[model samples]
Every structure is written in C-alpha cells, then in structure tokens.
Target chain A: MRFKNVFSIIGPPMVGPSSSHTAGAVRIGRVARQLLGTIPNKAAIKLYGSFAETYQGHGTDLALAAGLLDYDTDDARIRHSLEDAWSSGMEISFSLGVGHVPHPNTARVALWAGERYAEIVGASIGGGNIMIHEMNGFDVQCTGEFPTLVLLHGDFPGVLSGITHVLSEDGVNIGYMDVDRKARNGEAMTVIEADTKITAATQLKIQQLPHMIKSSIIDLTLRS
Target chain B: MKYRFLHELAAAGQQQAKTISQIMLEEEIAESGQTEEHIFGQMADYYQIMKDAVNKGLTTNTQSKSGLTGGDAQRVQAFSANHEPSSGEPASTAMAYALAVSEVNASMGRIIATPTAGSCGIIPGVFVSAQERFGWSDEHMVRGLFCAGAIGYVIANNSFISGAEGGCQAEVGSAIGMAAGAMVELRGGTVDQAVHAVGLALKNSLGLICDPVGGLVEIPCIVRNGFGAVTALAAADMALAGVRSIIPSDEVINVMLEVGSAMPSKHRETAQGGLAQTPTGRKIMENLKKRK
Candidate 1:
C-alpha cells in the first residue's frame, strides 16, 4: 500500500541487514543526532515498542549507537559500533515506553551536548523503513530518505513561495514538502524533500533569508 | 511478429542480467560497468560465492563427524571411506537430484526463513536434473539467477523481503525462478520461458506462510527451501519444454500481493500460526521471549 508523508520515503532503500530493525533504528538515531545538531557530548537513547522488546537480537541498539556516532548502514564499523559510541562519549539506555501507536516499532532518544538538549521520537516501518513522527514536542513528519532541507523560517506569508523559487532556480524538484507552525508570529519549520542535490550556496541563501530562525541540510543519499 | 511473448522474454533476460549485475556491484561484491566479458566475470563471481558458501559449510560437517568418531582410528577411517562404485550408482536422473535436495535441507542446511543456506541446491535440483536430461550448463544457471534477481529486485523495491510483509515467496520463490530460468536459458528456451519459470515459482508458494519455529530459521523452513528449489527448477524446465500456464507470471505476482494482503496477522511471521499454533511452538516462543 502507498503511504503519504514520512511513511512513503521510509519504505525502500539499499541497506545492510534487516530493514525494520537495522535501517529504522539507524534513521531514528540519525534524527536524534540531527536534532542534537552536533556529535553528542553525551546522550541517552530509550527504545520503546518493538524496538525495546527486540533491540539486541535485531541489532537496533547498535544501529542507534551508530547513527548517534554518524555511521551509515553499510559502514563496516557497525559491527563494533557500540564501543565506538561509548568511546565518543555517548551514553545509551533502553526502556519500554508506556504507550501504544499504530506501528509496533517506535522509539524516543533524548540527547544532550553540554546543555544543548533535544528529543527525537520516531517509528520503524517494516523492511528497515523509518519515519520521524515528532521532534521536540512539535508534530513533525520526515522520512530519513532523500536529501532533506529543514529550515526554521519566519512564520510569515510568502516564505513557502520563496523557498520553492530557490529550489526552482537550482533546478531541484520537490518530491515532498511540509510545514508546521510553532506560533502565529514567531518561527515555522519547513521540511523540503528534494530529488536533486542541495548545493552549499542554496543552503547559505536559505540561512540568510530574512527572519530565518535556523536551517540545516541533511544529505541522506549516501548508501546505507 | 506474433512472437511478442518470445521477444519480450529475450528482452527481459537481457534486462535481468543488467539489473543483477548492478545490484551485485552496488553490494560491493563486483566492480562497476560491463561488456560481455564483464557480465561473464560477474556470473563467475556469483558462482564462486555460492560454491564457497557450501565449501565453508563442509568444515563444520567434518568437525562434527570427527567428534562423533571420538578419534577411533577404525571408525574415522570407515567414515571417510567411499564404497559405492560409479557403475553401481543409481541412474543419474532429475528425480534423484530433487530427492537429494530434500535430503540436504533435512540434514544439512541452516534455514534462513524457508530459504536454504545452500542457495544453489534448490535451483539445481530441478535445473540440473532437467539439464542432464535436456543438456544445460553453468552459464544458463547463472543467467537464470540474474533474471530471478531482477524480479526479486522489483518486489524488494516495491514491497518487502523481511518475511514481515510478503512471506517465503519473496525469498525462496525468487530463488527458484532464478534457478529455473537459468535452466531454461541453458536449454535454448526463449526468454518467455525464463520469465514464466519465475511466475511459476512465485505461484507455487503465493501464500506459503513464514512460520519459523521458535523464530529460528530452522525446522520446516529448511526443508521448505529444498522443496522451493526443486519446485523452481521444475517450473522453469516445464516452461522451457513449451508448457504454458493459464496464468501468467505478472498475474501470479499480483495474486501474491493480494494473498499477502488478505493473510491474517498471525500467519505473517508473528510465530502464531501453522507450526507455531502447537503447544510445543508456544513453549519455544515463550522460552525465546524470556531471554534478554
């Protein structure tokens, strides 16, 4: 069955091992890392739902650790990734959350880097697919596939159109895009799913946009 | 040309070969780009991977045999001895190959969710048997796998291979088709026959459940791979020999998708149906779940 939003991009990719456990777990970790925005000085990952129950055997633990450390699925280092995460000063933990969701595989990883804190909640669809459902209490949907541009732009009219114009000028087609508002006159988050490569110039221009709050280009085209 | 099916099959074979080589290269098992020589080299690589896996398996078997003999020289000597004469051997036949596959799964293979660890045996069971009687080769066998991989790539691309969505059909059925098609290719059959063999393999196990006992890839899944391999070879051989199915390969794939959709959640590898229904199955699952 076809899925819209984050679920669509999450379904297919060339990844190592199983998709649901390995790929999904890695995506969740990657999201957590992105939310942290730096190599974590220290972090604690709590896996829930299916991830908590079968994390060890399914290699979900290693996957999360690898993502936090910025390792891709095909990284040969994944085999000994836990030690790597620990050596890099990342703290990890696991617990089953007391809740139910549509998908059995879900997780929450709370991260910290010297007081810079962020929370990432995500789900693993079957075959190693992952959807980042919520981030930092905001209902944000992002599939950890494709090269994504996430910008916290001004909560104002014409911001969306301007973003599209930039992409058009760059010859990048939009595969998917979504926006969420945190307030009436504060900041807004625009998650653009792109088919073409995001150049450095485009990233710099998006950051320099008037009233732009924060921006990051997340490139996920590297084979897992 | 009223030979639309034939032309399509030939085209499909070439396309299949290209895709399989691509995946192999992407997986870092082979290099990028190709000529006829490169394609053949990739085929050789595939052959060696299959052959080496089996060879590595022999080490464990030898160790186990040695342990059983407990260093008794006479016992070890007797065990190592080959007594049967080539003349006294039963007539080399396809049926013999098929039976041998069953024996391999039952006695040798560590099943990977209804797929034989020894991937080649299943396809060879039918392919080799038919080829012996009809004359085929290693090249045909490799090409069949390439085609099968193409079909598998599509399913894997479009659906799932974790036995979580689609079941054994996605794994063993794909393998069988590849094996059978290779057989057909070697025997000078048209590409339609190869694709049909894939369809035939998929059809035989459309809704075959993935009920690995205790969540281990052993027991019934192992034996099932043997059966799956033989079935694929047989399907490809029949298609090659000019036998046409009322249902086409594409239709069978659609059916597989439908059946997968209709299946109860319990049957989809939750360890809750078929063999998993028994008291013994429940106990095994419980024991596994209890482990950290």
Candidate 2:
C-alpha cells in the first residue's frame, strides 16, 4: 500500500546514475524550491550519512542544484545543473553532514533570497520517495507524496482553525493535517495534505487570515 | 497493503482464479482507479522508454561524465556478431541490452528504474532480449512486466530496493529475481514456479555488496548488470524445468532483509570498501574530486 501504483514500482522516468542519490536528491531540492515560493539567489546544501560519502559520483550535487533551479527529475539539463547555476548567478555550495539524522539519505537544503530564507530538512528514503521532516524550524511532516499546502504563521489559537476553515469552505478533503510549532504563541507551520490542487485564490484566502504570514502550495499530483 | 508477502501474490492469483498478471492487474486497478487499458498503455510507455534507452546507448560512443563506462555495449554486440559466444545469442543479446541501459544511465540519460535506477539495466536487458529472441508480443511483454513488478513490490515492502539501503543485492539482486519471475510467467510457468524462480535467483545473490569504484555507478555496477540478466534467465529456466528452491520466496526475502541489516555501512554504496578501496578506485576518486 505504501507504493500504490505500478508506476511507483516501474518508474519515475528519471535522469539517472542512481535513484536514491540522483532522482531523490533532485526531488528534495525541488520541494525546497517550491517551498520557498521562488528560486533562491543562494543555496547551501548539506548531505548527510551515505549522501555525504558519495554525493559527487552519483551526481547528487548536480541534481540538487538542478532541483533548486526548478528542474524536473527527467530534465536533461540536469547533467549541467552546476554550470547552469553558475551562469544564472545562483550561488550554490555543498558540504557533508546533517548532524545525527538517522536516515542514511538525508539532506539539509538551505535556500536564501536576500532577506527571505528557508531551511528544508528532508530524507530521500528510497525508490525516489522522500519525507520532509522539518521546514524553517517547525517540525512538520509533509511528503511531496500528495498535493500539500504548507502555511507559516504565528503560534496562536485561531491560526489553525482559520486555515482549515478556508480549506474546508472550498470543499477540499484533507487527507492529513500536522500543526507544528516552536513554542506557545510563537511561529508555527500547518501542513495539509489534500487530494486535489489548492488554487491560488484558495491560498490567498488562507494567507489573509490573521497571523498567517505566508503560504505555498506544492502539487505532486500533476504528472505526479 | 496486506499483499506485502510473496505468498500473498499467489493467494491473490488463487483468490481471483487468474494468472499472476491478472492478480497484479486487479490490485493495480483497485489502487489507482484506472482502467486496464490505461494501465497497459502506461506500461507500454515504460517499455518504450526502456527500448529507447537501449537503442540510444547502442548507437552512441559517449562515455559517462565519470569517463569510466561506455563503448562496452557496442563492443559486446560486435564481438557476439562474429564469434560464437559460449552463452549463445539470448544471453549475449540480454547482456548487450543490459550494458546498453547501464551505459545510458551512467551518461545521465533518461531511463526507467524498473525498481531503481542502479538496477535498471537487468529488466530491459532480459525482457527485451527475450522478446527479440522469442518474438514475445507487446501484450505478452506487458504481462511479463506486471509479473516482474509484483515480485518487486513484495521485495520493496519487505526490505528495500536502493543500494544505499541494502547494497547491490537489494538493487541488482532484486532486479535479477524480478526478471526471473517475469521470465517464468512469460514462458507459461505456474505461479508457484514464478515465485520459486525468484527464490532461486536471489538465493545466489545473498552477500553481494554495493561497492562502486569511486562511488560511481560505473566500475562493477555496469558489469554486474550483464551478469545479473544472465542469472535471471538461468533462474527462469531452472524453475520452468521444475527445479525447486528449498527455501520459499517468503523466507528468502526475509533473509535479504537480515543480510542488509547485518551488512556494514561502508559496503553499502558509501564507496568505502570492496572495489572502491582498490588503488585504481582511489585514483579515480581523486581524479573526480580534482575535476569537480
């Protein structure tokens, strides 16, 4: 049941040398890009455990760069993503180690656009599958396995209800919900996994709620 | 979800009173909510991709970015064209296709990861070569793919499919088993025989490590794909010939899980042991670093 379709068993239709290191790395990078809502001018990638030991041979470095630049898993341009990033003036750097993360394949992808910054901690488990453990210091569980809507807001009573109310009003069936926060009345993240795409209008409506700072919709269901 | 066992596939076949392909088809339909025709079209598309990868690699002399893998597929095919290969046409063709796909992958080309990219070579190598050898229909090939996929599904759920998780045994080894099972089904063997083919294939691959020279999927990785394909054919033939595995497929899979867990981290695709530690392997790693 974890792998629901034949496609999961057969493919990802990817550019390859290795799936866990290449395609999975690209996906982690892509998810980070989508989370930032825009491509970052600067990115610092940190590979952990097995990823640290063999990033170059598997094109994990290039693949992650391609992903942060918004390239898909099957994009041929991935072979030259490093050169492309340099030409685009998108600053990128890589290092090894994500401090005690249990998974063998983990990446802490940090993206920045001047003052706007987001840190994504994710693990590319296997079979091109990934699990996002934390984002921007909030412990949220959102895998790009489904169409997900992630919202950043202040930790308060009305934030969660307001966001869900907006989504429920649109008749969006929430498959799962995770409300992760730092402390009481501090910053927070509400991650909602939905069956269908959440439109821009819906995102704007949710963002307009009090304490809602930002929102981004990650749709893995398209060519998903 | 309950179909995470090998016996479950046989049970699924028995419950529906159908072949392994039909059982897999029913499971796929129930899960994805797509029609049989739609699923078939998608599988056909994947087959096309696999075929295209082989075609592309066979035509090109381009080496991978690592410069370690290339030109071998063409060389193998040319050598087989004139010389009488000891393994005969089918094995040679399968090996050629296997190397072709691996070459394509090493060069960063688009290819289907039957279970994973590292092991992509084995399935296309065995299946398409068999089709060319025996004139298997597109529909028949599709059925074979489902049979392969069912075995992969069980292996993936029970253990893992990536080299990083369970070494090359999990990647190439699983692909070998998958191709064997698929071959049995395509050759009209019983479901029990298909499962037995899986066991017979994997039982030989128990301790294979994921030791790529310089951490690249070139050195032993590309070469292993060819042998893996042949092993699949051999396993399929054995099962079709009524050879039985002493251990069942279910127990064999559990052994894979245990061995993977017991395997040291360095041997599991970290490029720290086996061939990766050899003099040339270290040199290649250094050269790659300098180039970067």
Candidate 3:
C-alpha cells in the first residue's frame, strides 16, 4: 500500500548515493522546513542508529542541510550544501544520538527563526519513503505523501469540527487525521492528510477559525 | 484500479486487452488522481535524468568524495569500444552504461532511483543501451519505465527493496527482475513472457547478500550493477525465446522475502561479513575513520 503509484517505484529523480540515507534525509528536512513555514536561521539535527554510523559516507549530512535550505531532492547543489548554509548565515549543527531510535534511519531536527520554532522526529524507512512520527513533542504520524494540514489550536470543544467543516466545504476529503494534546483543554495539534490538495483560501478559512493558533499545509506533491 | 501481484496484473492486462505498461499507467492515474498527461510528463522527466546521469558519468572522470571509486565506467566504455567483448555489444554496452550511472550515483550526482539508489543503474543501463541498439525513441523508453514500475511495485509490496531490510537480493535483484521484465515488454513480448522474465532473473539472484565495503555505496555495489544489467539482458532473451519459469513470479518474490528475512544481519549491508570484512576493506574503513 505504501507503493501506491508507479512513480513511487520508478521515479523520484534525486541526487543520491543512497535513497534511504540521502534522498530520504532530504525529504525529512524539507518536511521540517515546510512545518516551520520558512528556512530557519538556526537548526539542531540529531542522527540516530545507522544514520549516525554512515552519515558521512552516504551524504546524509549534506542532504539534510540542503533540504533545510528548501532545495529539492534532485538539486545538484546538495554536494556543497554545507558551504551554502555557511554563506547564507544559517546556523546548523549535527550531533549523533546514543540511545534507542524508533527506526534505523531516525533524525530529530529542531529549527528556530525569530519567534517561530518547530521540532520534528522522523525516519527514512526505505526507498526514499519517510514517516514523521513526532512534531513539537506531540505523537503524530505523517508520511508527506499527500497534501497534509498541521494545525495548532486550543484544546476545546468544536475545534475539530470547525476544521473539518472547512475541508469539507472545499471538497477535500480527509484520508487520515491525528489529534493530540498535552492536557485536557490545553493546546492541541491536528494533523490531516487529505485526498485532494487544500486550496489556499480553505487553509486561510481554517486559520481564522476560533481557537486556531496556526495552520500550515505541507504539500510535497507540488515539489515533485 | 490496483493489482497487487504479478498474476493479477497479467490477468488484468489480458482481460482489458492492454499491455502491462498501459495497465500500470491507468492504475497510476486512478490512484494518484492526476491526469495521464501529468503522470507521463513526470515519468518522462525521470527518464531524462537517467539519460543525463549516464552521459555525465561516462563523460566525466569524477571521483566520489571518499575517493574510493571513480572512472571505472569510462574504462569499461573504452574497453568495449576497442575490442570485441565475449558477451556481445548489447550486454557489454549495457554493462558500461550501468557502471556509468552507478558511478554518477556514488559521486552524488542526480539520478532516478528505479527502486532504490543502491540499484539505480540497472534500468537506465538496460533501457539506454537497448535504445541505442534498437533505435527506439525516448517515448518508447518511457513506456518501458512504466513496465518496470509495475514489476517493482509488486516486488516492493510483497518482498523488500532496502538493503538494510532484505540485503542486495532485494535491491539489485529487484532491479534486475524489473529491467528484465520491462525489456521483454519493450521487445514486443507477451505479458506471460514478461512475468517469466521476472521469475528467471529473480531466481538467479535469490540469496545475494548486501555487503558493501565500509558501508558506502561504492566498490562491489557499483560493479554488481554492471553485472546485473547483463543478467537482465540474458534473462529477457531467455524469456523471449520461449523459456518459462517453472516457479511463478509471485512465488519467486515470496521466496525472496523469506530468504532475505532468514539472512544474517552481518550480510545485510552492515559491512560486517562477506567482502566488507576483507583485509583491504578493513584498511579502507580504518583510513576513512582516520580522515574523519
């Protein structure tokens, strides 16, 4: 089921030495960038398991850096992404994690830009596919395979209904949805993977809803 | 709209009176909710990347960042141009092209991962070289990619395509089977022949381990891609010549999953056993560590 389309098997033109290590790393970084809604001025990246062991040999570091710069997977500039980051005044650091990881190719990336910040934990499962498991300390699952909506809102009654109403009005069917909160009636996060791309107008409508703090659409298909 | 197994795909192709590639294209359109023109355009772009990588690797003598591998593809191309190879022009040229794309991959150049980057070279090698030999247009090769995609989809869902999970059999073996099956279709063979080619190619690669020296995608990995292209050509010819696999393609894929699961971790891209632990491999690893 993961390999839904023919292009998933035969395509995804990418700059690579290894899809799982390099291209998948690029996608993880790209997803983090999209979540943050802009290139961060500072980033902290943590590599775990196999990624830490063979990151240099596989160009995982460079690919991750390039992805944070909003470069596509096929961008040849990945080879010199570190230099690019330095010249662009992007403060980035990489560290190896020593404990258990959910997957062999796990990475925890935290980004900060002015007053905005985001944290993501994701894994490059195989064949350039990724599963993002955590965002801002919330346990959620997103694959970046579809147009996804991530919303931060107050944990209160009618918030979920308000969001789904916007999507339904736009004719965007929700293929999957995950809702998580730190505590009852506190801040909460909603992750929605939609069957069709949500229009910018629909996203704005959700963003203006009561108790909605932030809304961002991670549309990976557009880059492809 | 979806066919999970080779038999199902073949039956769908037969019932609908379409080629496997056509069936795959239709399925992709339905599942992705994209227009046929858009999907075909994306695949066409990937094919162009494949051709570009082959040309770049063959033309340049670029070394990887680790300096462990470089220029072997050009050397092979020179050898093929100067002397008659025992394997004939088709196989030899395909081997050279395969080496080229793999070398490009090692250098972190742009390329399409047919299934995975470790086995990125096989489909381009077979398709580009065959295009040169048969005088086919890029459009024809794009359709062949759809055929390859169909086979890879089935293998990926049924077995595995990552070296860490299933060793090189799942990576290079899947590529070879995909290329063999696609080549059969491109050569105007029946859907039955294409399925047989998948079985024949995969049967030859059942227990192949994924022991890359120093865990980099160089050394044995690149050379294996070269050999894989030749095997794909031979398997396609065999299937086209009325040879049928006694074991069905779907059964072969299941067996690959079973064998890959049974394989030891050391032989599954861990760089612990096989050639990765050789004296020279250890020396290379040590040197790389010192540099870091």
Question: Which predicted model would earn the best DockQ?
Answer: 3
Weakest 10 consecutive residues of candidate 3 chain A by summed lDDT: A2-11
Writing each residue's lDDT as its tens digit, candidate 3 over A74-159 gives: 88799899899889889999999978778768999999999999999999867787889999989998988889999999999999
User: What TM-score does each of the candidates earn?
Assistant: 0.66, 0.93, 0.95
lDDT, candidates in the order shown: 0.55, 0.86, 0.90
Query: Rank order by lDDT, top first?
Result: 3, 2, 1
Across B109-134, the per-residue lDDT of candidate 2 in tens digits comes to: 99998788889999999988999888
User: Which CAPRI level is candidate 3?
Assistant: medium
Query: Measured with DockQ on alpha carbons, how good is candidate 2?
Result: 0.65
What digit string (tens of lDDT, one per residue) describes model 1 on residues B7-55? 3444644767533323333332222223546655555554444433233
For every model shown, the clashing-pair count is 6, 0, 0
Q: For all the predictions, what are the DockQ values?
A: 0.12, 0.65, 0.68
lDDT of 1 by residue, A1-224 (tens): 22221112112222233455566677678777876778886767766554554456446777788888777654556667889888877777766676665455678888888878878678765545567777666677777666788887778888888888888888888877888888987777888878667888988877777778777766654543
Model with the higher lDDT, candidate 1 or 2 = 2
Error of 3 at B211 (Å): 2.0
lDDT of 2 at B214: 86
